[model samples]
Target: MRAGHCAPGWNVTSMKDIEHPIPVRIAYVGGGSLNWAPTLMADLAHDTRLDAEVRLYDLDPAAAERNARMGGRYAEVSNGTPARYRAVPSPREALEGADVVVVSILPGRFDDMAQDIGIPARYGIPQAVGDTVGPGGFVRAMRAIPMLAEIARAIGEHAPNAWVCNLTNPMSVLTGALHAAFPGIRAWGECHEVTKIRRQVAGIANADAGSDRWSFRDVEVNVLGINHFTFVDAISLGGRDMLPAYRAFAAANASGVNETVPGEDAEHDRYFGSKCLVKFDLYDRFGIPGAAGDRHLAEFLPVGDYLADPGRWGFGLTPVEYRTRDQARRRARAEALAAGEIAPVAKRSDEALIDQIVALAGGGTFVSNVNLPNRGQLAGIPEGAIVETNALFSGLGITPLVAGHLPEGLHDIIADHAARQSALLQAVMAGEGGALFPLFHEDPLVRHMPETEARRMFGEMIAATSAWLPENLKGAA
Candidate 1:
């Protein structure tokens, strides 16, 4: 990796230094998560600065137990990074006395997610990724909001002083739910869409300098807007402006990415793939960098703009069937790993979870783009509405940095979603769907359709995912 690409202004020592490795308890709400939970296990095993005891809890007790065993094995083989793992029977038991609570859960099964996308597509409305916005996102929020609220309530009762890091979808709504249900909860939503920009910038920095790879940590960005619809106005590396280089990169890749972006491999591109065609397109059109991946960004804009024909833009809607297949494949792999049929690998994730934890636990200061209630950090969004913007994480607490108002058009675009997300959070919090129809009817993706058709589509989407939804919402439209 290129020099100076490591953590910027990183303190070599913190309250808990190398020798001490302060002990902390992390309550993982979705401990059975095939993807994120393992990543966290590896991260904890790879870090020697803090001792982490992770309690895994999931609806599938057996899956959680499997992960617990895998985590124990992972820690044992990591040259001893100081950690422990266990599977808890309930959310409260897992959360009690925890120093940090991680919430990363699937609201329902893969089939449920399929319905989230399929029903909308039946209306000739295509969504590249349904977990964030569009009709699929709203339906997801319907269940996820209540589920997260329940988690938040448990945290309030069991780990009142713990820091919460949410990694669920419909990010804005879910994160807002935490605050809405328990206003005193210390929580923020973590998403990696903005990190993609930093990684791209790192690649550009490396290529421009004619050196080895540069760590994404070297790049600093100014983020604005909501989770899936975030934007980066400025990027800097080593006290040098990198936007010009980024602008050039965007221009070159605007039509199609002719080369592999830094760490990407063509063979592995399907499960997580994007040439950032949407990002480049946004830069070309709006004079701003779209921070989220093409699939996610497509859902936020007018449906016809990208989702209508995503393939034409060099990104295709990842079929739900593919995710289902991938999950099954991953499940098998996880079983093998947990059964000790294969060696458990320990590699730190590029995500900022560990760093954020360290920073929050009196480790040091770090900055990253995260979903938090707007506190004047984003200009056009209302205070207390969840918005994604850069924030400083340190011992004192999370402090959102100023992300000035966007151009009127951009501001209005982002503000519209922010308002909708906040409104949805309220509706879900109160367990009421009175405003659901209006919110669905007004979404950028649904607004273009005739009112009657939009209402029909909305009702069908709601009914498709109604099993977990509250009684008042099963027939919302």
Candidate 2:
């Protein structure tokens, strides 16, 4: 046999020969509908180490067919390797023998959520307030948790050894549900927030783009608390603390911070206007970079800030507005497709972080980030608490880094939040409502509500979500 090549039924000459030779079967749950699927499929097709078979599962048959067709096109265009593509509605059929499962489901659909927020706004509650901190996030979480649990259960039965990666909102909450309910399964939740923050920090530092001198390594990001609520406690460049520079940058541009990059007229500034001021304020007070953008950060604050005089918060739109805009864009794209004005689909450059992990695992190097517990990867968080941290992957398997003791204040906050998330997950898994009230109270934004209003909002929010919640949580007053 040639070096670096393994033949079937090899003679017992070396230790490597006895290792498994089966091609890793990777399945993507909810992969068909996402705009990012084509690029991801292309990446998977190009990776030579593993004999990759990409299976795409979605409830929508047309969408699934569209995704598979795109994947086939990419294989021919990129690698000349014809990869297998399967579209199946059954989770078991899609997940069977899979080494990795990527999930990105939009349960309740964007349209339903637009209505959820819009209908509530008509009743005087701000629509965006519901998604991040108030009724919206809670109800969205309620609707999503059950579906995630169902996926977990299906993965448990069909793909017992596969690693599951969740890319959904209320990330920590959903990951927590999988951790509590499916003990044996390996899973993690990922979002673009941390990566986005890193990019912003780089731009703030005025680093050269093509040089290896500046990268995510140059910055030390201390992201504590839940996904969107994370704050960058410290940032450093070239082994020197750079918080002062960041502060100065914010101050100098306070009047009209043009976050737009130079020489890029077409580039829309990702962070701009009043939200930049809010980001500055957060940096000043917390000494940490805000992970989410100004729009999301705005929602976490008191609704009165924006609603004080109705329409005073200039250019600031609620989550429903964001959703509405996204829906319109999606509709336009669909119409373009119908009219043959646009190509069947276009490949996205950005790939889900999970796909990278799977590729690395096929090789023998491990990388770690926030993932659910698989041993003692996280020290202080309870055995199964979903933690965000670095991880390592290799032929040996995935291992999360053991984040040592966190600050007492941060620990307490994380623990409290984790408890509520855990309880909610448990409630969904066992179909119990006992944990709902405690979960609501644990929310940081809910802490700001008056006791009377908190109770009222809690009841009303639960009532609104009752139709979609587990049977046990439904009809509960």
Model number with the top lDDT? 1
Estimate the TM-score for candidate 2.
0.77
- How does each model score on lDDT? 0.82, 0.57
Q: Candidate 2: which stretches are off by over 4 Å?
A: 1-24, 42-51, 79-83, 119-133, 207-222, 234-244, 255-274, 298-315, 318-325, 331-355, 358-360, 364-368, 371-383, 402-415, 447-465
lDDT of 1 by residue, 47-161 (tens): 7777888999999999999999888778876754657889999998899899999999999888889988898888888887799888889889897998999999999999989
Q: Model 2: per-residue lDDT, tens digit, 344-401?
A: 4323233334334543455334232344542454446676656665444445565554
lDDT of 1: 0.82
Sliding window of 10 residues with minimal summed lDDT for model 1? 1-10
Residue clash pairs of candidate 1: none
TM-score on alpha carbons, each prediction: 0.95, 0.77
